[model samples]
Target: MKEKIKKACAIWNPIAGNVRRNEKNIDLAIDFFKQKGYEIVKKATVGPLTATQIARDAAYNGAEYIIAIGGDGTINEVLNGMHDTNAILGIVPMGTANLLARQINIPTNTVKALKSLDNVDIQEVSLGKANDRYFILMTGIGFDGYIISKITSNLKTKYGKLAFAYHATIESFLYSYPVFSMKINGRELTSAFAIVALSKEYGGLFSLTPKANLQSEQFQVCIFHKRGPFTFWKYFISALFRMHDKLPDVTLEYADTIEVYSEEKVWSQIDGELFTQLPVKISIVPKGLKLLVPRTAKHSFPTYKESR
Candidate 1:
């Protein structure tokens, strides 16, 4: 543990709203690590894919631990940069809805989270590979993707939680259903919406795929075939209640891989960033990412039974 803690890279996204507001918090985190006798190389990502390039360079320079100091989107970029490397990953989770960090029970308090890293229990989490890029959370298409497209950084910075709701409201009025072609575990179907998830949670708190596990090799792909204003509410309710599979218009499949296409070009978003457009091929890489989680933390799961 001491050897692994010697040299580390702190990959920071200075422009991330949460991080930007809590600059002093992160500075204390840096000081705390330095006090613990770790040689920390601070790298701030300037723009798009900057986090990835910085992480790749840090890894190449023999950084044993790559610590992410931004949101899940930042972590996603770092994962793509790692690309099959055997380096341990750590997280400080300074972002809107740090789903990955929350899943592993890492507190959002920058200093506390960094201190927890010393006693981390390393675990292997699954990675969703699209084309060649990696996504730490779920991949979205259709209405949700369109909603993401509507969210601007300025709006997110101004409104916070209401930003998504506002963007969704606008999207609901202006956007029509997207025509999708999907292949799940060999069967082909056309749908208006699709979500292929590697983690159990979506949109921070929603348990869209409650039974899904990040450490598991399988991916849960939920497809909604219905189109209309009510269709969004129906699916949204199911996701809100963690009953996505039971939605009347929804079909759920568990497979190692899935492919998605569309008659017209449809945009896709992964871990909050606008990703490649369809036709996309998504595959689950079992135990691909080595994540540093709290020693006492458990993977996020659904509370179905009264007693565990």
Candidate 2:
């Protein structure tokens, strides 16, 4: 009897991030998986939400593995397209802020990232749900979200990380920092900025929620109790040094569910995409997705054993 050939769907975003070199390796990636005895379906995104549709199509067609070859936002779309399929998720991290990839120890270099897949294993990881959508990274409410809402594709691709900083700096001075409320653990707390994190990496720079873990089915809610440009800058410096949690107005708590609201219109960024209009509900979905993680990322997953 002949064995069945497994199917793998490799999805890539041609225009995501600074992918001049990474885009060239699309063929290499497909061949890499092909050599692994898998039939590969290579697709590129034409615009927004295309990846999701492709992923859903692949899942329904019985693909065993769905590899995301773009950034976090692309990965998030692929994830959303996925339903209750037994397919495992993989990443090739090619974006300006590959925070999700960085947190999971996935290499930024496309060649190295593909090579690293040789020593990988599968793990069912927890995912965060913001309203009806799912996120592998944190949900940024207020400051960061405001920046995301204003960022353009050309600006992001050209300026890269500086694009966000540009908006963040300019808006910090002009915009009024409004205080919002989030209900966690049956308690209502007020804050200017809030981070509901599953992974420690925020904005692909610093660990905004150092205690947050992707493997855990809980969120490390980091809230800034004060509102203002001064407080924002202060918290920025403190978080940079990984000491913001020690500050007076900054507080970090763990929760499974969170409801954020405000009389003022608020913006949010989920895995780097702009999510505007507040009153968003966030909660943890335990063991929601099966992820193909490298052995090098064992530190991020404490309970991860070298089963392979």
Candidate 3:
């Protein structure tokens, strides 16, 4: 009459954000899972892409649940290493901008996020792939990507989310806006900046793509036609007011695949992590990832015929 114990692996990033605080929270998470009869295994990442390697090993070893204790970048890495496994993904949100956690209604507070694991509400979600890489949230080219590329590790460690804002301000004045040709599901379009988003939220708080839903096998592509200081300010203000979609120069469309090319080299970002240069292909992977969410969370995407 006793329940079976589940194997749970925690991939902790000790230097993600607020190192001391994150370490304490990770300790609490381990204790909580152990109390719930989970056979807990811990792995601490020391450098870039370490979480991905650790996650792959855990999945191959038959871990029932793999929890990432960092930001969106860490979660993205773990997802990439997960392969087509049965392990469910969980988030602890220990970074400056936990956009993935926010989009899925996961608690930003580390303790609360850990406690939500008790619900065991597992769901299969779609993911966006840029080239060979998989992104759980969104990807960007031009302005947003340039800003992320400029934000160094030292700045992030010292100023946290403020680092993004700082670089964005400086880049807005100096960055030369480059034009890119985008083919969205075969429809050709040109834009100065583009964001292919799978979630409604951006930077943890702002809702740049209000119609985006992670559970659906579709992406909300936002294209900005103009690129200048004034234009950027206008877009920023519109985003703050949640009316960017109404702007004349801004276009929002839904697509299952997108291909982008640039005459000149431009940066690209995936899930807040700096990725490769321009000339990339992006597509949606249907029901690609199994994620753990709160039982009470409301999904924006329409329900499928079968629930996982």
Candidate 4:
């Protein structure tokens, strides 16, 4: 563990939800590392400047380790910043939910998560790419995107997990589904809802794609062809329990690349942040990024299971 404590850069998001680490805590973390003769470069994220940019600069400046100090969104940005680069990425779960951290067994306690960094295990992980953007968790279209777009950040901060459910329920009632065409690995199809997952944990620790593996070289693609608002609930339930793979209305496939075309623009989200609309091309970069996991953390793999 001592040998692993080389020069590391800690990139922190100052406005990550409701995390309340005071000046003392930061000082303690910094001091602890410094006493061990580690050169810790602390950089706080300012408004609008993505963590990826900060991470890129850190790597370009020769930082061997890049620690992301926020929620999944922050980690996603950091990952994007260091994409295609051979740099080690670490996480401190400071934002709401910290789904990625939980999945990797990183302690939510800032001190312990930081201490565990000494024994951080490096794992090559897969990422989902939409156009030039990379998603660390999952990407959604159709009804899922509609629900995401409807949820306000203030509400999410105030209500935490319930915010998504509250907004999803309202969107279910008010938002209408859009018919679209999808092509998975060059096979043509149509669907109103689609989920391309790279990891098992969706937004609130729920598994949207039970068989999705972060280390796998493929993406788990789920497309719901049924149209109309009534059909939204059916797919929603399937996604919740990750039992949607075997439904007659669901088309589940594993692929390295997928192209989505729509009669009109389709909404999309990656790692909970809403991005551009589709006619978008999505793909998985197999073992593209090296991530830091706790020493005790064991990576989970997917197995085929019959969904009734």
Model 1, range 21-68, lDDT digits (tens) per residue?
888877877787787677898889888898998888888888877888
**What C-alpha lDDT do the candidate models reach, one value each?**
0.78, 0.86, 0.84, 0.75
Cα lDDT of model 4 by residue, 61-178, tens digit = 8888787877777788898888777788877787877878777777777788778766655777888899889987788887767766766766766676687777777777777677
Give the lDDT of residue 149 in candidate 2: 79
> Clash pairs of candidate 1?
none
Task: Identify the runs in model 3 with alpha carbons over 4 angstroms from their true place.
Answer: 299-301, 304-308
lDDT of 3 by residue, 47-103 (tens): 888888899999999999898888788888898888478888988888878887777
Cα lDDT tens digits, model 2, 167-205, are: 888888877887899999999999889999998888766
Question: How do the candidates rank by TM-score, highest first?
Answer: 2, 3, 1, 4
TM per prediction: 0.91, 0.96, 0.95, 0.87
What order do candidates take by lDDT, descending?
2, 3, 1, 4
| Winner by TM-score between candidate 4 and candidate 1 | 1
Candidate number that wins on lDDT, 1 or 2: 2
Instruction: Specify the highest-lDDT model's number.
Output: 2
Give residue 114's error in model 1 in angstroms: 3.6
lDDT of 3 at 203: 79
Which residue pairs come into collision in candidate 2?
Answer: none
TM-score of model number 2: 0.96
Error of 1 at 172 (Å): 1.4
